[model samples]
Target: MHHAMRQPLPKPTPANLRRFAETPVARKAINTIKDQIAGMRWRIQRRDGNAPAATSDVRIHILAANLDAPNPDDSFRSLTEQVIEDVLVGGWGAVEVQLTSDPQRPLLLWPVDGATIRIYAGWSGDAEEPRYAQVTPWGRHVDLRNDELVYVRLNPRSHTPFGLGRLEVAFETISWLLGAQDYAARLASNTVVQYALWLAEMPPASYDKVISWWQNEIEGTGKVPIIANLPAKPEVLRFGEGSDRDLRLEWQRFLIRIIANAFDLPPLLLGLEQDVNRSTAGPLLEEAFRTAVVPTARLYAEHITREILGRRLGWNDLEFVFEDLEIFDERAQAEIDEILLRNDVLLPDEVRLRRSLPALPGGWGGLTYTQRQMLIGGQRSATGDQ
Candidate 1:
């Protein structure tokens, strides 16, 4: 007998990962990371001094406005949300940047489906060179140059041009979870009987009568009392231990935790707070920001700066940044501010500005505590002489 070698199954693609992401726990994990990244406040700043503008260039204003509102159809926040979702599900986020003749809005950004993007071979390590193309639904390929699009990867790999998505990491787990959920749904839909009524020493006609009464009358009625005067007493026989313990819910919960871990999110955010306490909750959120939000936000900002700001527009001095990436701890920030003030690292007016407060009247607010005391002492001495 000749033995036939079996061919290996195809590896999971972005579309397969996206289909798995539609599961409840997987979707929650992806959306949690997406919200954290997309909700951040982004800005364009100069690299030389980190100022709002490097010079009196009109291009800065035009670029800022274009970034704020990519086009009339899409806002920056909405586009970012969709792009981050794509990155989380597909490991790639792409946006086609079309240059417009309008002076006010010179660039129009349209999000390209990451799943449809195909990277061509024979690509050298040139950032400005074109290497990608988009495959249309009708089987047409549209070339996307490197400078014409902003493409970001979640976890870039040297072996392959594609990145590794979080969903891909937990694909098998999510598949098992979905299967378990489907089984539970089947149980809930009365595919299996939980309890059956056994009438001992009853005629066939009487058993049929009782079953008919149950199917026709008792099934749809909401918990109404049943006063049955049957020939034999009915014995209740339970099939298994119980539905609560039989569905393997603990297994499902374990799968949810695995999916959350793959996305670098706390299980609490994915609706699993069983092990969480008050003391750990705050720290868990901070850890999430550090692990999940910061990396993705920084990657997004870097790509925007490199592709859109620097390469496309030739604005090498300007870069993109997300202002609100840090998890804001009011008490910790206040303590740091006090330490800075005591050490004369920051002036009172500078601290006020940092807190978004109006500066104090006159130049007094600019002075440190020691300087203010010395100025008051000099003023008092002059007043005594006068």
Candidate 2:
């Protein structure tokens, strides 16, 4: 069923955005984020109000396995990388959930190219209704309901059904960067000169001979040895004024910073390290993770929890999260954890979970250090009373 078409305004299409993403600085910035996100671990936790409760549900077990290996062709990391790349370039990521007959792994997730999926401008209030349609290889449209697919949009806006891509924001900058690089390449390849040869008051035959001789030997091959080179002495006429920076390096670096800003990254991540030092590097990296990586990972986690766990499997108690996603480095996080533990702000098990370590034996991790000390003192007091 089709409602009023959104009639997209003049903007960069997914193709154009992807083309720009392939450029040097953009690709580096995107890949850096993608690699970090993909490498992080995903966990399915039962939402027990901050308490870590182990789950015994078979469906949840199957889900964990399925997420580990989404399908035969893609692992969790590979699928995650593709989804993130699609979101960065096109502002959308799509995954079709396929159900299998096998009980061990009852579901598989296949990553769909966002370009093939079109979101309905008008969404029906019913959750079961189709809000998106996929254009097939045979040019047919297949409608997908909310639960059957996981569709994530980055930087969604009210004006349009589609999300706003980072590359789209930097489209003109990328175009300028590409143009400048192309011009510089042509200048280098063509061996551009600062001056031109002007044959002053020379015979037509001599001019033709000079032209022929230049084209044949000296044009692209550089200045050659000429004996006496006379008959009007072909004066050199300078064409343009010279500049200090000819390769447009400063312009390209400025454009790279713009691109980094569009992606909410620090310019240092994109190889603009002129302003960064050892003291500032950690802070810059932390800020980048806070601004760019954390939000992106949380967005994916939310979609997965809502669509896969809530809508499809009816597992309201479960939540999906990326492990160790804090912006703090290990040392900082360890210090924070130590402080929290010292102050009895968190239980040992909770800190262990954050560190991705297994719980201690005999459920000893559930109590705070002070609580354990008090319990041990009470036990000795009971022994004395006996």
Candidate 3:
């Protein structure tokens, strides 16, 4: 008989640790973070600082419609959600745009997994253009040019061309938190008890029989009460006098806060609402969106605008814009709108559109009244009152 030599196992690198950190439980947390970021409303707007068109321009409509319906089955919203998820987990998200026979129109927008797509910098004759190689399902590599792929990277490292995900930093803490949860669950399900059984002056055979009976009846079902014959007593003791479970719960919560901080998320956003109240919750929500969600949204917008809409489709002025968060005070917005309307900055129809109301009858809605007229009217009213 002959023995074959065994290959040595590979050392655990940062990439390997990152891959390991993407366990089922970790993936659930990542999804939650991504969902919160992607829940924001997004739209296509002109980069020339003009108002969004009443009727979308033909080029804008085609692009927006394609993004809204990336495929026959998927929408742009869902695609963006997944892209953010990938970017958070792997530090990059990429989408492939397939053009129609007419280069101006896009046929499909397909999301490519960041993990499967390998980016090779300086592969093309142009130093700025990075070549992409996507691994197909059949184990072959499909090369994609820069115009065909929209790649968004987060937190790129100094040396490596690739970006670094937050998971790489928080992996150990998240792993520990998940492990602690599993441990706590196990302890809750299978509580520990110290027991002492005493046999006083009992015969050897009878003692054995009693012990066997106790094992079968009491330990097996956990329903039967401990019973002993004459001169025998069974005592079940509590493991600890202190509240260890409470301490464990506190530790778990502390770990959760650490994980949230690593991802730049508010603990309240992750359902840890202990210290949050009406006053603090609003600020926390705003802070979370401003710090985390807004940056991610901006990254996506810039990449999509420059890569897909600007370069590929030749729509240089077309850009993606996320709607202002609805967390603002309606009263404040109304006051500002009124001022703008009086100053002739915004037409009546513009204000009406903002309020989701139909325009006034005929073209009267488009007329803008000046602040001078308002001031004159106020003077007349004051004189008439006197």
Identify the candidate with maximal TM-score: 2
* Candidate structures ordered by lDDT, highest first: 2, 1, 3
TM-score, predicted candidate 1 vs. hidden true structure: 0.78
The better-scoring model by lDDT among 1 and 3 is 1
Task: Pick the lDDT winner.
Answer: 2
Model 3 per-residue lDDT tens digits across residues 245-361: 622688778877877776777887666889778999988877877777767777887898888788777888878766554334568777888898877888876666444455677
Estimate, for each residue in 295-339, the C-alpha lDDT of model 1 and write its tens digit: 988988999888987888787887887866652577887898789
Using TM-score as the yardstick, the better of models 1 and 2 is: 2
RMSD over all Cα atoms, model 2: 6.0
Q: Give the worst 10-residue stretch by lDDT in candidate 1.
A: 1-10
TM-score of each: 0.78, 0.89, 0.75
Candidate 2 lDDT over 176-237, as tens digits, reads 77776776675556566657778888777787777766676776566673634556877768
Q: Give the poorly placed runs of model 2, Cα more than 4 Å off.
A: 1-11, 50-52, 55-60, 101-103, 191-194, 220-223, 227-229, 240-244, 379-386
Which ranges of candidate 3 are over 4 A from the true structure? 1-33, 36-39, 52-56, 102-105, 124-130, 136-138, 191-218, 223-247, 325-331, 339-386
